[model samples]
Target: MTKQDALFQYCLRLGDDALILGHRLAELCSRGPFLEEDLAQTNIALDLTGRAQLYFQYAADLEGRGQTADGLVYRRPERQIYNHLLCEQPNTDFAYVIARQLLFSAFDRFLLEDLCTSKDERLVEIAAKALKETRYHLAHASDWVYRLGLGTGESHRRMQQALNDLWPYTGELFEIDDVGLHLLEAGIAADLHTIRALWTPEIRQMLQKAGFEQPADDYMHTGGLKGIHSEHLGHMLSEMQYLVRAYPEATW
Candidate 1:
């Protein structure tokens, strides 16, 4: 594929990841265990959704297809989305929610830090702004991981179970395909190998401190990068894209 094509896919994957994950977090807005934490999750959702918008805008420029961020997000079908399988997984419980957040944030903090040096100015700018919020996200989620994992017997069991279940999906975050290789050669992307190097130890330390054992590398489930997704993503889009699809381009 051309570099332009690679960049478009790269941005699509990034934007889709953020948009879907933001939607996941937003689902917790009124349902957080308490008011302050509820607002915190909502604020993080805003940060993620804003980041998705920035990346989608860049992707639209690359595509030159007259697509706005709203058009790209709301108008896309399930087969067109490129988010990771992990991001679209349902938040089944608070332990699961915190485990998912901590896992993603751990990798994201390092990944965005490296992307800050991208040759692509737009990526660099977006990464710089995003890194700060990701750091906060990691800290918040990591604290909860520690608290819940070390708290009571039931909480500890739940936290460990969540970690074991989610570990398989973590591998996909660092999977670099041809598009990523091309972007890496152009100095517009971080080396996923390098990012994984940094991410592994940091995440392991958090789990250790939480008194949880890291799960073995078992059978893994992937395919989201190639537009294959879990059933949850389509269900999410039904709710999220309703107003945008129903209204087309109504300027509010």
Candidate 2:
């Protein structure tokens, strides 16, 4: 693929990841386990959705397809979305949701930090702006991971179970593909290998502090990054794309 195509596809994947995860978190809008956490989650949800909008806008520019952000986000089919499986997974419970947030945000923080130093001006700018928001997201998730892990017996148990269940999917976050490889070669993206090294120790420490044991090494489920997703993604896209699909050219 051409450089532009690779870049555009990379942007779309980034945007889709943010959009799907934001929607998942938004599902907990008024259902947070606590009032403070409810507000926190909503704020984070908005931050992510806003970031997705920026990503889609950049994608439109790169693709030069005359497609708006709404077209890309709300109109795309299931297989067209390149989000990781972890983002679209159902938010089973508070612990599970927090585990998802913790894993994604931790990696995102490192990724954006590295991206901010990219040789590509546009990517550097986007990363610089996004890094600030992701830092906050990381803090929020980290705090919850600690609180739940170090809290009461039941909370600790639930948090441990949540981490274990989500562990299998975590590997996909650092799975760099062709687009990523090109970007890395051009100095326009972070090194996933390096990010993984930093992320793993930090996460392990957090789990330990929460009095949680790490799960055993096991094979991880992959493929979402390549447009192959779990069963949950189809249902998510069905709901997310309904308005656009129902009225193709309709706009407010």
Candidate 3:
């Protein structure tokens, strides 16, 4: 792909990942185990959704097709969206929620930190802001993983199960394709190989602290970057895009 096309795909993937994960976290609003945590998850959701807007707006500008950020998000079909599979995984439980956040946010933090130095000024700006929020996200998830894993037998079992089940999805986060390679060559993208190098040890340490071991990598799932997604993503898009699909011309 040409550099412009690569950049557009890059932005699309980033925005898709953030938007899907934000929606998942938003689903937990008012349903968190407690009030304070509820508000915290909501705030994180807002942070991610806002970041997704920034990326989508950049992508829209790049596409030059008269698309707005909202249009890109709310008007896209599931097969056209490119979020990581891990991000779209359901919030099966509190343990599952924390496990998802722990894995994704840990990688995101390092990736955003590297992106702060990107040649693309807009991406650098977005990554700089997102890095700050992702740090908090990682910390929050780390704390919960520790508590839930050590608190009781049931919580420990649940936490371990979540980690194991989600482990396969983690592989997709670092899968760099042609678009990524082009951006990497142009100095506009963070190196996933480098990011993975930093992410793995930190995750292993966190799991160890939580009385859990890193789940063995077995049968990793793929295809999100190419727009293939799980059934859950289709269900999520059906709900998330309903308003825009139903009222194509309506505006606030």
lDDT (CA) for every model shown? 0.91, 0.88, 0.93
Model 2's TM-score against the true structure: 0.97
Judge candidate 3 against the unseen true structure and give its global Cα lDDT, from 0 to 1.
0.93
lDDT per residue as tens, model 2, 93-159: 9999989989999999998989888887887888888889889988888888888887899998898
- Screening candidate 2 with a backbone cut-off below 3 angstroms (N, C-alpha, C), the clashing residue pairs are none
lDDT of 3 by residue, 119-178 (tens): 999999999899999999998999899899899999999999999999999988899989
On a 0 to 100 scale, what is the lDDT of residue 161 in model 1? 90
Between candidates 1 and 2, name the one with more favorable lDDT: 1
Q: Tell me each candidate's TM-score.
A: 0.97, 0.97, 0.98
Q: Point out the higher-scoring one by TM-score: 2 or 3.
A: 3
- Find the candidate with the highest TM-score and give its number: 3
Candidate 3 TM-score, C-alpha based: 0.98
Angstrom error at residue 209, model 3: 1.9
Each candidate: RMSD to true structure?
Answer: 1.2, 1.1, 0.9
lDDT of 1 by residue, 170-226 (tens): 999999899999999999978889988998998888788889998888788889889
Candidate 2 contains a number of clashing pairs equal to 0
Error of 2 at 163 (Å): 0.3
